[model samples]
Target: METAFIESPLGITKIVGDEKGISEISVLSEGTVSKKIPPQLKECVSQLKEYFNGQRNQFDFKLNPQGTDFQQKVWQELLNIPFGKTISYLDLSKKIGDVKAIRAVASANGRNPLWIVVPCHRVIGTDGSLTGYAGGLWRKKWLLEHESPSQQQSLF
Candidate 1:
């Protein structure tokens, strides 16, 4: 697997993947070393840039997130979350057909290795508050703000 760090509005991001597909994309607030960009990572980085620029809503790159079957299922459901929409962990649990698994659902969301591409940031607390995010609450807040149309500035 190849790896590289790319600076983003939220923070420095660690991207890892190979020819088959992307395995992980992690947001890092610090402790990142710059490395050579791999040719195979070009597409992933391009799509991520588009996403951050608000030019792309959905990603088209292949992915191979490492996780348990349940975690994969949870992450797949996360992809269904719309670009500017949010869903509660309870809602996600119901979508997965396991209402009692809300905590499990939230856990899987926290474990999502693909980050923005998987849309784990779209999951919020039942009370509509920002909650657990491996990328830190501040970055999560920035991402939510970025996706909100009301928070967007008019360039015109």
Candidate 2:
């Protein structure tokens, strides 16, 4: 696999993949931005940049996130959530066809390897509260606010 890094609003972002398609993309603590991006990962980087810039709402690059079959299914369902939208974990579990699997679904959602691209940040508590995120709750709030179409702009 190959890797690269870029600065983002949340922090430094790491991207890892190979020719088969991007397998992993994550947000990490501040780190050195990569000087050279692998050819196989350029599109992933570009798309992520577009996403952060609010220029793009959908990702088209091929994805190859690694996970168990059940986790993959949950992640795939996460992809179905529209950009700028949020869903409760209970709702997500129901969408995945197992109302009783909320905890399991949430576990799989937490294990999603693709960060913003797979949109695990869109999942929240049934009470509409922001919940667990490997990237941190502040980053989760930032991502959701970043994607919110009706956000207010500074009066400056």
Candidate 3:
């Protein structure tokens, strides 16, 4: 697998993949950005830049995240969530056909390897509270606010 790092508002983002498809996209608190992007990962890099710039809402690139069947099912369901929307973990479990699997769903969500692309940050606690995020809660908040279509702009 080829790897490349790019700077993002939240931090340095790492992308890994090849012609088979992108297998991983993760964020780091600190890292060096790639001076040259791999040919195979150019589309992903471009799409992500558009996403961060608020020019794109959905990702259409191929994803090859590694996970169990259950986790894969959960991640697929995560894609159904609208771009500017949030869903509770309980709701996610129910959508996956197992309300009792809330914890499992949460665990899988936390393990999602494709950060913003997979949109794990869109999942929240049942109380509508921002909950667990592997990238840190603050980054989650920033992402949510960034994606909020009705968000306010600075008066300046």
Candidate 4:
């Protein structure tokens, strides 16, 4: 696996993967921007840049996240969620066809390794509050706000 780091609105973002496909993309508290990205990681990095710049909505990179069959199923279902939309953990469980698996679904969502690519940040509390995020709740809020189409116009 090859790894590269890039600066993002949330902080240093780490990308790890290889020829098979991208396996992980996570946030770091501190890291220098990668000087040289591996060929396999170039497209993923580009897409991420476009995403942060609000030039892209959906990612089309080849992903190969590591997880159990059930977790993979949940992640696949997560991909069905449209961009700029949020879903509660209970809603996610029901969509995955097992309302009782709410805890398990949330656990898997928390374990999502692909970060923005997988969009686990789109999950929220049923009460409309931001919830657990591997990258921190603040980063979750940042992502949601970044994706929101309506931003306060600069009056200056």
Q: List lDDT for all candidates, in order.
A: 0.90, 0.93, 0.93, 0.91
Predicted candidate 3 versus true structure: per-residue lDDT over 13-125, tens digit per residue: 99999998999999999999999999989999999999998889999898999999999999999999898899999999999999999999999999998999888999999
lDDT per residue as tens, model 4, 27-116: 999989989999999999999999988788899889999999989998998898778899999999999999999999999998899998
Per residue, candidate 1 scores C-alpha lDDT tens digits across 1-156 of 999889888878889999989999998877565667898888999899899988888899899998999999999999999988999999999999999999999999999999899999999999999998888888888888888977566867
What's model 1's lDDT at 99? 99
TM-score against native, each model: 0.93, 0.95, 0.96, 0.95
Q: Candidate 2 vs. truth: CA RMSD? A: 1.7
The residue-by-residue lDDT of candidate 2 on 1-156, one tens digit each, is: 999999998889999999999999988887999999999999999989998887889999999998899999999999999999999999999999999999999899999999999999999998999999989999999999998877635555
Clashes, model 3: 0
Separately for all candidates shown, the number of backbone clashes (residues 3 or more apart, or on different chains) is: 0, 0, 0, 0
Candidate 2: stretches off by over 4 Å: 152-156
Lowest summed-lDDT stretch of 10 residues in model 1?
A: 28-37
Ranking by lDDT: 3, 2, 4, 1
The TM-score of predicted model 2 comes to: 0.95
Residue 33 displacement in candidate 4 (angstroms): 1.8
